[model samples]
Target: MPSPNYFKPSHPPTIANVPELTPYYYDNSIRMSPMERAFFTKIAKKDKSGMVGGSDEAQFFRLLMHATGAKKALEVGVFRGSTTAYLAQGVGDGGKVIGLDITKDYLDEVDAEEFWAEMGVADRIEIRVGNAVDGMRKIYEDENGSGTFDFIFIDANKDDYDAYYEWALKLVKPGTGLIAVDNTLFHGAVLDKNHEEGRAIDTLNKKIHADERVESSMLCISDGVSILRKK
Candidate 1:
């Protein structure tokens, strides 16, 4: 069974109401609690990909890894390394996580080394720069020589999803391997019918469902995510 749908809000709440209910991500904009808030607040101040994954999304990585015992894991995006740290928390000590991204430098303003150290699981992550699909290929090669991965998170460019899906599947075992695709809901626009991202995701979701290699479920969480586990 897949996680409950939360991102595709039947009727999105208002931010200016008496209770001031903002969007799922909007609530994180304001910070408190000193260090934890400071870290997130710093990411919020940026306009670029400095902080990509919100807490809810990061928790997806953490919980899924925990549930799957994903010692050998892969992430197709590494913006600012915030999500990387979250995965590190899930696969700690003897476990390892491979994170890849196209960008060489993200949030260079922040102290990357110190932040991971503060998180205390810095040693388990390996970051690489290249096309995410290409990076997925490298992990396949690594596993061919070593062992298979337990899980993979696909949060790279949405346009290349089909290619990433093909490559990521090769790195894990069928029926046990887990894959999650980000931005599947495409911001409530999947209902719009004419929007580009929505149309593309709608088409892709159909293909994913029909594919014999996996059983998939789309969650309305943090931009419409889909979780797939090989059948």
Candidate 2:
């Protein structure tokens, strides 16, 4: 159900972004698969920025897949294929995942082929390195206008999020399909309306909120996640 906005708050609601809260929450939450834990540990150790989604958020992707019983999924960004692994697992047996990335640099850095194989999901996933929009366009074209995906995840170039969402709407199954956009809040930048990416995300958030074709919500999760279901 969509969140109700019936009452106006007298005081501004406090948003939580404490550093210690992560460890505390992860400690009490459900444990990730051993492979997910190891791969995430590697990402956290080698990737200084920690841009990749954390275990809990990654698990949420898997949860979304299960919730919708998604058999075919698309991930728009494949940074080191960390979250891609979870997406692959989420699709269950005989399912497929298409991963699109702007470059193979990160995948090469991590030996993605061997990594996905080690994760036991190599055969079910396909990696496409190029412009994400073009890749999605090809998929839509190849699928003959009919929605070819049950789930689509967008975590690519923030500036192009609106474009990606437009394409995703065309590719995902109507009513049943789900589209998830990451970093919707952009580190709280959406609230301040600073920078190009933040402004882009803010615009999309508002558009999705008002868009009558889909039902959506912005979750206050890691960096903020927005889920949209086509009507």
Candidate 3:
């Protein structure tokens, strides 16, 4: 079910320049009670920043998983497993997610078993270390792999998004597959011609929008996200 406070598409909430509002957004979207919010607030206030999985981007992934009944998922950047656990639980124990990260610094901050125990769906999660491309390749070449995924979240290095998208394209089947790219808006920098990040994301957006291989929607939510459903 959609959270009661889900900021509508027409009236999207603006993210601040810092991670100050991120904790609030994360707890808010989880639909927690006041006490629960306080608990998360404590953890969030101690957060100095650069925590990847707790961003609003994670909310988008969770909704996508539920909306499309996505049982198989791939997260290119798994920082602290915040989004990984969220995605894994949303689809339940029957689903699986390949959590790929270049390093485990953020993931090691919290105990995986403890986190998964709370989620009640930890068995479905798989953690992999390496670059996104290598991790993706390993999954595809697995002997018992289906070579098919219901959803793929590209939140890795900005420079490698294009490569990730291209690689993911070959592994999906039409109609039931969803590919979502995060940080495409680059915190509204994409609108400024002076920002290099803007130019890079702008280029990716146009390319995917024009591609006939998939049907797409560009959502301005949380740093700008582009969602493509394989045609």
Candidate 4:
């Protein structure tokens, strides 16, 4: 059985129930530049996977970056570069966002480099194509065996969540850096007995909860997001 608190909502989802409030709420709270707006629209029209992070979730990421004063970030998944663009924007001038993906096909399809240039964040974003684990390990070694990132976002294959978290600890600054994992609730599938991805996510969720090296909170923002701050 799944943990009782696993699927609980962090807050009421009135807007979720009422779809009309989506645009209204986003217009009022989330600010997107013209380039960002164009990029989202382009992705929606072209990409059919629907894997892009939602507006509220993107806003939460931006807020987290601002709150932590994060200048360096690492993103484990770079799906179509939507969230990567948001990460770049969040880090601001002279900041850097390292994005890792299993393939370069999606990044090419989205013309990510050109888009980043238009957004004036080309220098701040670097796309590393290959296995995420290997890329993360290289980053750790390159940092001279010390934590170098202020923030890390993991949203890759669910089965590899634990591995990503383990590496994230080595890459993040203790007591200050934040590690945010997406889709922890897995669309409430964590309650299903036979769902492989859900089971993997649930395992990581429990592990994070009991981890003495970090302070954690699980919020049901979009599918579910778990934030961990290492001590």
TM-score-wise, the better of 1 and 2 is 2
Against the true structure, whose lDDT is highest? Answer: 4
Candidate 1 overall Cα lDDT vs. reference? Answer: 0.71
- lDDT: which is higher, 1 or 2? 2
Note the residue pairs that clash in candidate 1: 7-220, 185-224
Runs with alpha carbons beyond 4 Å of true place in candidate 3: 1-30, 33-57, 142-147
Rank list by lDDT: 4, 2, 1, 3
Give candidate 1's TM-score: 0.79
- In model 1, the worst 10-residue window by lDDT is 13-22
Candidate 3, lDDT over the whole model = 0.71
Ranking by TM-score: 2, 4, 1, 3
lDDT of 4 by residue, 37-145 (tens): 8888888877555677776787789888988899999999988888888788889999999999998788778787788889888899988889999899888787563
**How do the residues 1-231 of candidate 2 rate in per-residue lDDT, one tens digit apiece?**
323672535433333535656667778875766766666666666654367865677788899898889989999988888878888888988999999998878877667677778889888899898999999898888857458789899999989999999999999999899999999888778877558888999999999999999999888778889999999
User: Higher lDDT: candidate 1 or 4?
Assistant: 4
Clashing pairs in 3: none
Q: If both were scored by lDDT, which would come out higher, candidate 1 or candidate 3?
A: 1
TM-score of 3: 0.77
Name the regions of candidate 2 deviating beyond 4 angstroms. Answer: 1-20
Which whole-number lDDT from 0 to 100 does residue 178 have in model 2?
A: 92
Query: What's the lDDT for all of these models?
Result: 0.71, 0.83, 0.71, 0.86
User: Which candidate's TM-score is highest?
Assistant: 2
